[model samples]
Target: MIRAALVWLMLAAPLAAQVTEPDGFRMDHYRDPVPETVAGGATISPEGAYQLWQDGAAFIDVLPHAPKPANLPKGTIWRDKPRHSIPGALWLPNVGYGALAEVTADYFRRGLTNATDADPSRPVVFFCLNDCWMSWNAAKRAADWGYSAVYWFPEGTDGWTFMDYPTEQVRPMAPQPSQ
Candidate 1:
């Protein structure tokens, strides 16, 4: 009986920490945006948000690359995409910058390494598909990495495309300085 009881205790240990009193348990930082209640709980119009991004609001597009089969505005601006997309945003993928479900400590470590090594004033944004969870998770990961200015662009490519914003095919590799 004592052995069985010991086994039960061990099983319950992990569960205990995972459980919480409903009222005392709130994950404020990880919680969804307290939607503009006036505009409805989960849906925020993109007009305002897009303007904010364009106006130098640091943002991250979730896709490691721009949308496949790109549809974007024509002209010189459309060809060689800017590294700091949308004026001042940095491009960082939410899914560890590797293959799907590739998030590991190393993935996170490299992400932070790359981010911190860049301009500190750069606005970091994480994004993915419309209404997807990857960006949220990525943004949280970025926050965990001590990025004070992380933002999540939930509207994603769909929002950008629908609004007629230009998107590049895929950002080109940075040119190596000539030896």
Candidate 2:
């Protein structure tokens, strides 16, 4: 029985490691972390997000930006296909994890200011893909920046799409270089 238990423990070791491992680039593969609070904002459901939207909350999409093609031939017209988000959501790609950096943080601040018209009291919701941490981090950043009302829509674009909500195609703005 002891030998059998040892074998089982060895088998479970790798699975335990996998569970605790930090996700690098693939943020959409795991389940959302369960906590009463994230950063400084509270997690919100899709229905809650819908209500917030109806109440005139600003929505920010914090999905990672697709990398530019490295070796496009000269004169090749390389336009990005329009990306879709929950209707009225501003596509602020690369504002998730990158916002942790000082330069990117400045950019996020500016974007949030413009999105909320510099009104710190305005309600703001942040989201990315379902199960993604980018929105969580961004929402926290907003709260840290002294925003009065900040929320994290953990259900993200996937959840919104799953609910058959209407989406609008949007063009992403180029990020300004960090000064």
lDDT of 2 by residue, 62-149 (tens): 8877766989888878777667898888888877773266767777888898889999989999998886777776777688779978
lDDT minimum window of 10 residues, candidate 2: 17-26
Off by over 4 Å in 2: 1-36, 75-81, 176-179
lDDT tens per residue, model 1, 1-179: 99999999999976743322122212333223322111111223457557656666545554544433456555525433344334333445434332234444444445545544655444555555565555555655565555665655666666666877766543423322357
C-alpha lDDT of candidate 2 relative to the true structure: 0.77
Ten contiguous residues minimizing lDDT sum, candidate 1 = 34-43
TM-score per model over all chains: 0.45, 0.74
User: What are the candidates' C-alpha RMSDs?
Assistant: 15.6, 7.5
What TM-score does model 1 achieve against the real structure? Answer: 0.45
